[model samples]
Target chain A: MASEAENANQAPDEESIISDFFVPLARDWPGAYGLADDCATIAVAPGHELVIKTDPIRAGVHFFSDDSPADIAWKALAVNVSDLASKAARPVAYTLAISFPEQPSRSWLGDFTAGLSEAQEHFGCGLIGGDTDHATGPMSLAITVLGEVPIGKMVRRVTPSVGDRIFVSGTLGDAALGLRIRANMVDGKKPEQMTDHESLLVDRYLRPKPYLELRSALRAYATAAMDLSDGLGKDLGRMCRASGTGAAVYEPDIPLSDAFMAVAPESLEERRSLISSGDDYEVLCTVRADNVANFVALAASGGVVVTEIGIVRTEPGVTIIDKAGEAQDWAGRGYDHFS
Target chain B: MASEAENANQAPDEESIISDFFVPLARDWPGAYGLADDCATIAVAPGHELVIKTDPIRAGVHFFSDDSPADIAWKALAVNVSDLASKAARPVAYTLAISFPEQPSRSWLGDFTAGLSEAQEHFGCGLIGGDTDHATGPMSLAITVLGEVPIGKMVRRVTPSVGDRIFVSGTLGDAALGLRIRANMVDGKKPEQMTDHESLLVDRYLRPKPYLELRSALRAYATAAMDLSDGLGKDLGRMCRASGTGAAVYEPDIPLSDAFMAVAPESLEERRSLISSGDDYEVLCTVRADNVANFVALAASGGVVVTEIGIVRTEPGVTIIDKAGEAQDWAGRGYDHFS
Candidate 1:
């Protein structure tokens, strides 16, 4: 797989990376070098406790077979740490268990480590401990990230109230559009596919950003929040379910960007399509309607994108309004693990 | 699958389990909810911290396909925690991911959860997180356990000196022999199948107790140590490799239960075979000769078996002598993960 990449004849396989990358995790880590053991030990200290989360990336399921190893590593940690951000947690440590196809090339490992290094650097997360091995076939990358949150302030999903207004950070649907581009689709993706926006969207697919910078503000302002994965429509469905309230989202109110406008244009059909497409790693949140203006203003001061998209209602179902003021039809959209 | 399981059945439909069993992980683990994001929140705690470990259990590789689900769960945690015990760490929590075939039986899942609950209760370990999904085929279980240890006290497989006495806790070969029993070869496992002494041998196989009680003392007294997952021959070879030492064993001095006499009274070959079989799950430590007698007596008082199997030597090779002073030849006898 490493040999086949079109560019970068250099792959991730290097002895230096093996030695330099993970040594300190064992040297300075609380319970490093705990071989043949259940867990490496962490000695809790004042003002810091363990933050932990796990997510699985499976071969041929989460990524294309041809995707670079670096991307795989990035997504593995990014997805897990993104959860930390929602709780306003500061990531401190992470461990990885990667099972690869037997005799995998060393460059693949090198690229994977580079991705991990990049993400860790971005988040100030240290590589604490991990394990690796060869499996019969298929690759499964499982990561557990440990972070830190201030005492008594970690966010929860069940905090949205009936009168809360729904807000979203960043643009949605780009990742799903990127998926279309990867599959060689032209018309289905937003109009921007004809231009350089294609690259931006595709990058979103390959490397969804972890919004570590937004954690503190989220803890301060948003009553409830989650990253928009599995599509805005489906994931919003999850949040509403958790908070026990219904929602009414106005399509025209959703915040769109120049990148999105250049791609989506102002078509009613195109706007409807964005609701159900998955893989946008933006934050969807709820706040009292009275705070929407201040929330947007505060987020803008921080240089983050926040748009009021909807409101929580007394009823218990997600309702979407089209640009033409008609109710939009819903379908079985979004990725379901079984379906 | 649910039909045969009984009154308390997990949803038989694969879709329901995907949504119900795995999804509830977010609800059950408040630390990981991260406000309904892709990952969970983690942080370092005051006076304590995070430790990480990952271990794999493959079908037909680690356990038989026909083993009950409950037993499989117990074995999975047992093997992983056995490593923690060797390090004298207190298990804090764990995350589990299962890559399983489609259409597993309902009885299997119920049993699997039962086993997990049983082991968790026994070890005082709570499962904080996990992922479950369908693999292409075959069953694979990977569990990552986290434990707590005091700063600077966790043990490792290093630091043994040339003169350290090599020690092993608990009996060997019984679990290996137990495998033989599971395979319908009752040659030496069952007590009634042989004599009274041999029955005790069978007990060792069914549930090989890990030396959790000895963890603290070893952390204080031992130079280097490892769990005897494989046989003494190979596991000791590993300890020597890590510590850069050789060993000399007085063959007749190796502890042998009278079970050997009952199972194979006249067969020296059978005795050797029993010794070499793996899955002992005992702790193998390299202790200074000065501490040898004291260590043995200390562990014995705790109602656990501890024996001096050999001595670390300045010579750069392993040497074994029989009762008659004749050199005894043995191959690398232990479990090899890969052929």
Candidate 2:
């Protein structure tokens, strides 16, 4: 996909932008045709099935319009690949379609592509070809991730059985708290004036660590699985609804990072709001009671902590139990784009 | 993917929109996980390599902001699948990422998805999964098409040899002309006052037919190929650049439909302008000089008309020769996003 003209400093056009910036990002994938051909080709590894997912983000909606370009690029790719991780699939490649408000400066593109390259290397995937175009509206990105899983072994999101143990990876609420901080809507103290632990919460909102390393254990032990994008409460509710089942989660047992705890709301209603807020980007699953110990051990080996939070039930809705042994009411079910 | 609540008369939310509208479109693909899971899994057909391409279109850019929903849907899918067609690949599946400025009316979604469904059937590909979100900007679509070709057999864009016969499928300039008509930039007459042939050109601009029927012959006989999206002159220039060769296109031999002949500007300059305007969506290719007869015969059997418009040359740039045996200067190549 390279051209002699690409090295020269010139006004960017569609072709030159692709050859100069995108071509290097595609260098490792021989099938990418170096982003030159009409399409890219890849042979699925034998004994595997391809797992695919597409996710999109927009300025002012998913992230602030003025957010760092690098963080924007990372989140765009991370969210799509995170879906693959939740399916117990290992990343292989990705295609991105990006629309720009205007022609971004070369430095903006450089930082953006650098972030993309880093994420690709970190996730062990290569960049395939994608489409780039101008937009008279807000900048947006749509990424499609391609991954592989052992044949017939992808974990399902609708197979949790009654009495199965419900578990989640890492912690939640940090991202939600971070959002409040970014909007300057926190109850007290501004982001810059906050403590280190509070600042960590903001970072959590900007960059989520998808639990890819624990994918194997999840596939081997979980009865059902899904990524926690729409917060644990709503997403877990979705999994329950899909399986024609329900879940009883102990409110106090829901994991929260130290950073989230430092700035978190104390009132039961506010705590519930934070708990049901979106963008955790962690795994939520059910394991047979007998396999819970093994699953935890296996995940720990990969440096991901899995905490048992509740149990699946035959009842048909999600119920959260307070420390006082009473059901608590929440206003909304995480973030719903249309709602 | 369907839910009982979906049929209720209520304001749409993320889940309801998906259940009522997107689910039915996904029902045929078991691997789509009923659009319930975070990821979808598909085993590649044995011995086939996956050919992937992603293309996004936006309101006001790729189409009029007020274009019909069905046509927009068709164009979104068709453009991506057209890339597959250029690669001589047979499509298997696709994923879509859509962003909306506001929640669309059910009727809009109905027509949009209906158009998508029809395109899927027409292309023989299934909708696997997709992501939907709200945008504070214009409605936009990004589609990733996955097609298949026999292992290592996908056609390329950079193998045209010197002295190769350059052929182009179907007519050029109709889509470009259609754009002008739609924009009221047409000379002398309004669209409704135009003849059927002129209206036909407008239709061509709106709905491009990818030359899929000629794919087999293209792979078998053509030295190199690419779909003409950015007009013949510019795209041909790209192909030559990719192959490190040049081209000599005979102006008189360039294919033009009867519709174009009626409204086309007579001056060489204006004609060249029409030829270089974007959105032809035909195929431009170079066949070995020896394969010309057989290639034309095979394409005819497929009901595709290909004309020998030019020849490849050892020189390294495109030369459009006029009827008077002189090189004509043209300003600008086809569309470039940044430019």
Candidate 3:
């Protein structure tokens, strides 16, 4: 899209920005036309369909404005890729629409595009086409990712049956804890962190590594799936509502990382609150009883940890079993932007 | 994407927003799963490829922040559709990622979704999936459109031959003039009451109707094509440079609308400047000398008025021939956001 007003003369021209920064990221994709054309083309295999997702993040809204540009770029792509991974799709290409409040220095763009290059290589996708513009607000990026999945094979969030066992990948609440740690640092409530666990937690908050390797296993055995974005409690409630069922999650079974254990509050209430704080990009899935062993084994073979944390039920809302063996309602407890 | 912070309590929740305002937009697309799934799936026809473009617009940057929400929604989708139309592709679906600085009123969202509904009907496409967030900046929308064209048949912006005749759809400067009118109104230079011509110009600025009916003619006849968002001089220069050719555009042959002529300044220089000022959203294309007659006839049959404005040249730059028949360099004169 074209901006209505000409920007300050200090910024680099659009042509140079594309040629010097974005063009290299697009070199691997022939269909990108070297970013010289208005649109990009993608060819889907005969029996495959395209899975599409668009997610955008803004500075100060999603991340601090002073955060590293490379981390910002990676998070923007990673979030969208995480959705594709949960759908059991293999990413093919992506388009990036970026808005800058002012002209960024060459070093910032260099680190940003370098981050994009690294992400594309890691995820096995390439840049196709995009739009860049000057904004009257904070810097924002919207990335639309295209992935391929066999027809009728995508793991949907609305397909879980009453007897399905719920599982989650990796650990939960690490990013949430990481975010809190950063908030304390910004508030001067803590000294410059010295703990390795604190650093690990902050890294988790900065860059989420989407588990693309588990796509095959999920597609083969999961009855329903979605990425844990809005916290497991609320997102699982959404899935259950869509599937016309409910779930029972065991608090003791909810996986927590070593870093989270080392740095988080000791109170069970606070721990539970952090668990539902969202930003966990891990895949949340449900498998039939008969396929649980196979799904677990396959995911394990791919070096992805799968922890059974819950079970689908005939009830209409999600319940979390406390360590004391009492069932407590936990539906709608995840992060809500408008709440 | 999940927002990291909770917004003020005054706004409607995200769940209600999606179900009330957006779910209807996805009703026709089964792969959208009623907007309940994490991602949407698209199936391409056997002999076709997907043509994708992502263009985003922001309040205060692309349009006035107080612009009608309906008009804002329409322009966001129309600009992207215009690009696909220039590629001779049929828009199939689109994903919209929107950020609002605060929770918008129900009435505002109602009008916005209605506008999206109207646009989808107008363009023969459906909304698939998207993300909504509360921003700390101006409201912005990033729309990614997916269109389809026969394999290897998408019009290229890099294929114009030396002898090809250049053509452009519709008029040249109505939108540019309209934008000027809007700026004057904002600046209190224009009266509150607008002439019908001025009103028409403003409408052109607000909502661009993509010339999609001419896609068949373009796919069959045009050697190269691109949408004129950055004005004829600069965009044509881009096509020429990419195709390794030059162009000579005749000033007398440039088309203008009755509304533009009635309200625009009478000076030849100012008229030429407006013609080069960007935001036309029209198609600029090239046809082989032998195909010009057929292309014109077919475009005319489709109710599209395509004017022959120039011819491709063996020289190395775009030159505008004045009414007095003197060639003047007019390259790189279009809107550059960073300029």
Candidate 4:
């Protein structure tokens, strides 16, 4: 055990941090070896394969430095869970690798691990293994999630047929608008006080609740699927290009939350901006025209509302129809980290 | 496809980077979907379980920022592969998530991916999936490796018996000395010129070759095993504590490379320092007294040299016996990131 004298001039060492805080998250998984082993083992059921996804978030780039440690932990895991959901897989385990610029306070670590515990419980997964190190830059987290599905059953993002109907889970644009509102507040351009609707938008940005309930519907009916991380316009373009197809989306059908509508104006530019922004974390998928009714009904039964926003076309690009019925190409219009 | 015009103002966007540099690494794995899908699936053979490990490295912390990108890539994957080897598992696939402070140049990315290609081929694994994002901090790479072992056959780190003989594969302390040499060079405390032995030590620090050939031997005969990343003295203490046992290591029996001996003085303090530094990446295990001969023969047949360094004890701490036969406790004497 690590004593206070051993770390008199610093925070707890790596061994102490893992033993004191992270070990509880691994208690439910026998193969984790209580985080004592170098590697963790998972037994895959017969006739099933493991689905894997990794998405890392960095401080200031993915979340604000001032955000609650619990929220940061939740967001890190939720984004990876969102990807697994898009693949129609059930998450079973995850590994978190964190790098800290400085030694974190014990209180901060307590809150962070508490948040991780809550996240693992909510996602129905266990923490199997991870690594912690000191960094000379901002803190960052890279989470790799492991899910399972029957052999050859994971939904593919490149199998959408030309005439399939394109659908999206949950309301779009709330997270993006929430990000904008937060940015305004950070810049001191907006009032310090926010309305409840504005707070909802900010909440959407901070904590994206992935639509894991839609996994069954997607696996059963969707022909192709992917999570909407880079906004509908850009991500849809990627799906269409990969499938050798195109899409024609109706602008007026884009779903918006009550909070988004309550805060933002109803201008065409606003709609386009929302569609082009990133961080939705919703599932974007294509279903066979014949299976649309069944897919919608199954998703609704699971308490998830999926909206048909467009139809895949034979052409090779994405077209967004304006309220005036004018079709405009909207390909490659989303957040680009390098741009 | 992303065009030049789309990235005229900055580095190529994430899509172009994935398509141009990363997709080729995933071509060998069918489930990778050419890096087009959000997640990848891996089918485990019947009666086998998946072993997983993740270890991330940060620039300026784990490696110098001026180091070659290819070496950086190799070290990132090799470290995680070392963990899987310790569990007696055969690596199959891996996911890489990299966050860059700024968009890397095209040439830098080319070398980085080429290095990954070389490592995957050498390690008998394939790239499955990954994520790339911009960071406001230093560059970091988090690699998660997936391996396979027969059900209930994984060599654990917490099952060493009190009477087992502790062994380690390969020579120790070369990498630690190499790191010190590099640090001295960076600080201008040493001359720019280096001897051949010094260069060899530096090479060990830059790229560690894990003792993967010992996997079969360990699975067949070892009672407990783990990779030695945090020096023998500290890692052995962890193993002992986890298994409710202790260890008595012979200082004279500790293996040292010719390069390390030629450069490092033959002093007790130097030996202790070498045994307390991190980043060895060698396999450490304990074999039953009855199986020691067979284990040694099996490891030798695979061209790996196993050194009998100690014996597991009934007590609860690690002791290193000096030339004078005086036993000194060295339980918590390894590198700690926060300290």
lDDT score at residue A159, model 1, on the 0-100 scale: 70
* Per-model TM values vs. the true structure: 0.83, 0.94, 0.95, 0.95
Ranking by lDDT: 3, 4, 2, 1
Question: What value does the interface RMSD of model 4 take?
Answer: 1.0
lDDT of candidate 3 over B253-331, digit per residue (tens):
9999999999999997788889998889999999999999999999999999999999999997899998899987665
Ranking according to DockQ, highest score first? 4, 2, 3, 1
- Tens digit of per-residue lDDT, candidate 4, span B147-205: 99999999999899989999999988889898888887886544348888888888788
Candidate 3 vs. true structure, TM-score = 0.95
Compared with the true structure, what per-residue lDDT tens digits does model 1 show for residues A1-339? 433455344323322333544553334344455333324555544654555677777877777656777888787888777777766678777777766665455456556777877877777776666656556657887777777665556666667899898888887777776666755643354445447877776778778886777775687778887777667777777777766788888877876656666666476566557656766777788878777777777777767877788888877778778678876655235666555
The reply for model 2, stretches above 4 Å from the true place, is A1-11, A185-194, B1-11, B185-194
Q: lDDT by residue for model 2 over A6-101, one digit each (tens)?
A: 634334777767887889999999999888788899889999989999998888788887777888988888888888888899999999888988
Q: lDDT at A220 for candidate 4?
A: 95
Off by over 4 Å in 1: A1-39, A185-195, A255-277, A290-298, A329-332, B1-50, B103-105, B180-208, B249-278, B314-338
**Per-prediction DockQ scores?**
0.40, 0.79, 0.75, 0.80
**lDDT tens digits, residue span A171-204, model 3:** 9999999888877677554535448899889888
lDDT of 2 at B251: 84
Question: Top model by lDDT, which number?
Answer: 3
